[model samples]
Target: MPLTVNEIARLLKVRGVSQYGREPVSQLEHALQCAHLAEQAGASTALTVAALLHDLGHLLAAERDNRADDDLSCDDLHQYIALPFLRGLLPDAVLEPIRLHVDAKRYLCHAEAGYWDNLSPASKRSLELQGGVFTAFEADQFLQLSFSNDALKLRRWDDLAKVPGLRTPPLAWYTDQLAQVALPDNQAVYQRLRMLLC
Candidate 1:
């Protein structure tokens, strides 16, 4: 079953206290900062929600194993892990960007001059794990996705969100935005069941 917003929130609250990979901030703090950046940029509600939940896969992974060891070689593939959990709950506008944000990083590394130099050490390590910089063909392909621009925007915010003590709106502040972009519970459940039966 797909998790409800409350369920996801509870999971985040429990698991997001771990360090965000090697970053100084916790996962929840990074998320809040990213969402704050997106909101400050005047993103749509869907994009804002996407920013808030983009790293949810990391939390889910930590739930399944100890994530405090500071190992960067595990290739958690976090970009893809949260999609099944969130598939029906959020619209494509939100989910697609979350799905592609990792690729967005790769895309930016190749497409933007000096972008790679600005990445944190942890992000640079993950970049190698995430296939390093994209080839020109790969960059072209990523840009073809419908939500590519949004993903890039989210990626930029992700890069800037690691400031350790940065103040941002609380997670509770985004609940309304989450609710606005989420699929109705019944509709989401029905969609999941239909997919299962198919």
Candidate 2:
């Protein structure tokens, strides 16, 4: 079921306070930091919203299943979990990056020197659970996916987002960004709007 923007905000406010996979920051903090970085980088509103909501699946997982991050033994597949909730609510430009960010981390471990070494301990652990570094062919395959490069950029922001005590814009700001890119995917809306010009 798709979540309302208010529902998403409430989810973050309520469940997002828990620790983010043993990272120094809470899940909400991590999200805010990633979105802040994207905004500072002059990313598109869609991309910034993607950054803000990338880890939304994590909140949903715990909320629905009552699983603590500490209780998980293996990959939680959090990247894919947010899709059903966000599919029609957000555009593919935003959704695709959220879906592919974990693979982006794997691709980075393969394509970038020192990338794996820089991963935080929690990130490193999750990477192992997420299937580790991509092979040469796997990296190429991942590159072929739409928005893979954007996912890489998002992954970098995700990695840096665990910083403690970082201040970021409130969730409301990103919710407005979400609204900006939440335009209908159908051409009808565009066609109808075009007729308004005199």
Model 1, 1-198: lDDT tens digits are 566778778876777777888889988899999999999999999999999999988888777676552568777888888899988778999989999999999999999999999888888988998899999999999989899999999999999999989998877888678877888876567667867998
Clashing pairs in 2: none
Q: Write the per-residue lDDT of candidate 2 for residues 1-198, one digit (tens) a residue.
A: 366676788988888899988889998999999999999999999999999999999998888788886544777789999998887678899999999999999999999999999998878888888998999999999999999989999999998898889889998888888877775553335445556753
TM-score of each: 0.91, 0.91
Candidate 1 at 9: error in angstroms?
Answer: 1.1
Candidate 2, which segments miss by more than 4 Å at Cα?
Answer: 184-198
Q: What is the lDDT of candidate 2?
A: 0.87
Per-model lDDT: 0.87, 0.87
> Where in model 1 is the C-alpha error above 4 Å?
185-198
List the lowest-lDDT window of 10 residues for candidate 2: 183-192
